[model samples]
Target: MAYKPLAHIPTHLISGILGVGKSSALLALIQQQPPEEVWAVLINEFAPAGMDALLLQDQVPQDAKVTFAEVAGGCACCLANLPFKVALNRLLRQTRPDRVLIEATGLSHTRELKHLLTGPEYAQVLDLQSVMTLVDARQLTQYAQHPLWIGQVQAADCLVANKTDVYQAEDYQNLQAWQMRAGLADKPCYLVSQGRVHLQWLMQPAVQEANKAPTPLFSPIISASSSSAYQAASITSTVRLTLSREQLAASWQTWYQQQQKTWGTHIRVKARLSNMQACYHLQAVGAEYQLDVLPLEKSSPLSSMQRIEVIAVAAKEDIQNALTLWAQELGILDEA
Candidate 1:
């Protein structure tokens, strides 16, 4: 059956940096979906393996009317590209969703993505609602001056201080200090745990032109060339592992420490692993890492395969070679 011309479908852009729990936030929102409404989610990942969708698929309520599409391996900020437009158009036409949620990659430039959504082509199709940017108060001091981080914050209609359950008193203070210093004191800010934000925040009308901060002088991360000073690369693998959860986590932590000595401290790693006993999720950034045991019953067929994604501000070749060597060393990848 033919549907309406895709006009005014409530859409929200969920933006954040690496390891800030964008997928977690989307999962929480999906669980809150109205019983009668259909929701379509479009997720973009910086790495080719694209594990976020797999991680979320089994976690969403089995009864919710939710559909998903993903754009992986590259930033989806460029509307001129066919991959992004095709995925989005196909989703809207096929699902005829009552609401839409877009989760952009952590390295994405939201200003461009927002511009495209409001442009003539999609302006009528999507009722661009709120732009919610999730922030980890703990990273304020480390990434406050980073241009990409600044862009995400400036494009947000509201800021969510996620992972607050683990935050210390000083983390809260840092958030306030950064907000005032960044001239975002007037913007709505909410503190939540495990990426849970009230549904009301998603309904807030987006005022991008009025609230957006001035564009930064440097090139946006999506458009940066190989020669650009802000170099970064994402290396991913999909080989099943033979090690236990504890052994896998320990191996990664050791690898991270070794790489830091050569590549400095800027890095992010995420992996999903499963063995006969249980499934696990691992996330690491800077000098710290966390490994969580997940319910085996919730595992999908895709979850059975091991997946690893490493994103760092180092040479692509260097990162790839290092990961291959590390995996082989751990016997996760066979020597060829």
Candidate 2:
């Protein structure tokens, strides 16, 4: 059956695990939007720096046609999903865009978000075209990474295997098994790289994309009460750190690992810090983190002051507090 395009404004929700290329795909999709129509992108992140907002703003021209607002502090569904609605409604009311696109926090439960979108309150306002999930082919190569990605599979209206430029034989085999589990291979699943999804393809509403009924999106509180489960948080500190970029990178990784050993996996963390070498970007998922030198070259010279933003799942405040204490222990606590 041919998918029908709605006459109303289309709102797209792009979801994926952290570092899986949702923003990259979204940037590609937004660039294709009509130049004359006003398009609003409401981005949520767990960091105050709001890296996605910076990345998206950098790609899109600074014009009236494209407007952006950011929701930071934590994932959208946390805190009773209030902050998400407040920020989203504010963006929508203020922008009244011809189109609305929401890039949810990487750790957000897409099912929870979808429930909100289709619920009576928003159904009238949001012409939800689809929920697109982007996956990294490299991550699919691992057997253990499967559980981490299942939520994305269940909630997406389209499944895009991105970064195929790095695919190996094992990755393809793993993907086959994954797709079979998802029942999305014969649906609208696709393989692409560098976030090149066409905007038109995602807007198709009538296409039957998945073989199974929609999977449960949340487990009553996103497993909030489970002692074994993870909870998400944002940790920000502005302080003086004298370490070099390489040193900072190493330290961040070590800290993440030590915490993971004590608590659980650190889902993702993005930090911008100014050190003697330069102000650099630190990106981490699990325990691995890297310092990108290119952003440094374009960045301003380092000052004694560095503002750090961290987003991770450490389960309730007990772990979150410990992570905060760890950041302070690094002697980077900034009072300002």
Candidate 3:
């Protein structure tokens, strides 16, 4: 048997609204990848302070060869084309990685970026892995009325309707309506919480036959499971907990069930475990579950860190309360 050669660097373009958890999702992905694999992350933040770039750098594996690029001052999709090209060129020239993750600012144009990556010049360097859009469930009503929103939805290779943890029963009804409005009923858009995504789905290739057909609301290539659950959009809260090697797996199962119940429609729970030998991970996007445990360096600091970074995607009050509750369950860190 023979297989088509995979791209040298599987780059993902993550685009979404300003507060829709794009940065958080990028952080989670960085946490999951092995350090020795060599990955380059390019973040183009719209804000002037470069805060998102700083946060992403902090999450990188210390020993991993990582290059952080910041295109600040304006929307990368509009005013930063040269900067975007420079960043890509620099990453390819300096630290050649197996994959690159581009976290696009809310106002950036997905189609433009796709054009740039798929253009003849870039084809020799970067592989366009996928264009993923993050949608706000609570804003579905508004999104349905906006032309730009429809454009964004149409351009995505994968659509993640995030913050499902806060969506009401009526919201899904509205979501179905919204889905119909966008003419994306056939596209494969998963209602994921806390940016929880299946690495397997990310790694898999797009279905060539379906890719040639009319627009689809979801990817036909996605593997289905009896346990997978899909939800409407809503708020979401995430808490990362560090556990002992002996206590880790069992503790996660208990927490996951409690999370699905307590946050119910208001949460999406994801976990990453880094012990001495490897990093074991699990993500429940609605009812779907995926597990992967990859080997790590013996002397890596991952084991000692034993840290989980939880993010709440709804309101400030909800975030504070969720953080408080999690701190009690997972123990808060003392001030340095």
Candidate 4:
């Protein structure tokens, strides 16, 4: 037997804004993976606790040939950064996967990451494919002037309007109008619900050239010491505080209502919580929120611990204070 080099691994970047279903889309793609082919996923989350990985793990089949790694606490946009390079290199060497999926943090600018993937270092090892940017049709106007959002869209080879099941006719029209206004009307677009993207889309030729000069709307790559436009804080408790389903929702609503003005339009919160009767996953983007019950058997190990991650545009102190208040009201802090 002779040692053989692996073929170029197909790589895809799944980019999106806060709470736009990037994780769900990535999970859907993972579920569609062929059993024989090994796949690797790199997830970047603004929160240090990496709640997305936990939630995603709960849903992924235990027997699937998928490997996941997370770069938490900040965006992994810069290739020179040690964490990004180390995690990616480790995964590539360890798994030797057929494909790789990198999910950028919602607040990340993808231009640099895209450049890294297509750069000389990876040119021979990775086949950089379509850069899929997912958009929530309902928030087109809300993020119209946002630099991070603009950068992600500009770096995309294709666009996906996820969560289409909740969209009204006007939302679709706004998406079309925005695409034209952004000079992206000619780009490949898909409308899907619950991030149900077909596998073929990932194989499309990447039309966005990495060497092209970025538009003014595309913000500069974030630096280590530079102040971010957003603030993120994580709240964790070892004991699960008992509350009725209504009480938990009401508590969040009350806290959000108090901080809504300060948090502005960019607020997002994800949590694994429990009520008196069951455990649930709660996700809130802007003012809307949804809760889905989690199976006890799958969530038991984590059920005793409640974890919440919040991202907002407010000051870090303000974000922390608000979350603390919310936690106190919900009895999460008392146990902590």
Q: Which stretches of candidate 4 lie above 4 Å from their native place?
A: 1-6, 78-80, 208-227, 275-277, 300-303, 333-336
What TM-score does candidate 4 get on C-alpha atoms?
Answer: 0.88
Candidate 2 error regions (>4 Å): 1-7, 31-34, 46-51, 54-65, 72-81, 137-151, 194-196, 206-228, 237-244, 260-266, 275-279, 293-331
- Every model: Cα RMSD to truth: 3.8, 6.4, 11.5, 3.8
Candidate 4 lDDT trough over 10 residues, lowest sum: 218-227
Q: Report every candidate's CA lDDT.
A: 0.78, 0.66, 0.57, 0.80
User: For residues 1-336, what per-residue lDDT tens digits would candidate 1 score against the true structure?
Assistant: 556557799999999988797888998888788898999999987777677887787577555688889988768863354788889999998999889999998877887788878778888899998899999998876664466677888888899999899899999998898788778898899999989987788897787574355444333333323213323344334556678877877788888888888876677777777767777877777776788787777776565666667887787788788877876755655334
Query: Model 4: how far is 233 from its true place, Å?
Result: 0.6
Put down candidate 3 lDDT per residue, 1-336, tens digits, no spaces. 233233456777888755566866777677777755667788876544344554444345566566678775456666748887887778766766778888886656666676677767777666776577788776664333333344456667777878788789887787777677667687667777877765444554322221122233433222222111222121112332355544656655566566566554334444444544555554443444444555554323433333332222334355445544554554433333
Off by over 4 Å in 3: 1-8, 145-147, 204-336
Ranking by TM-score: 4, 1, 2, 3
State in Å the error of residue 299, model 1. 1.0
Colliding pairs, model 1? none
Clashes of each: 0, 1, 16, 0
Question: Which window of 10 residues has the lowest lDDT sum in candidate 1?
Answer: 221-230
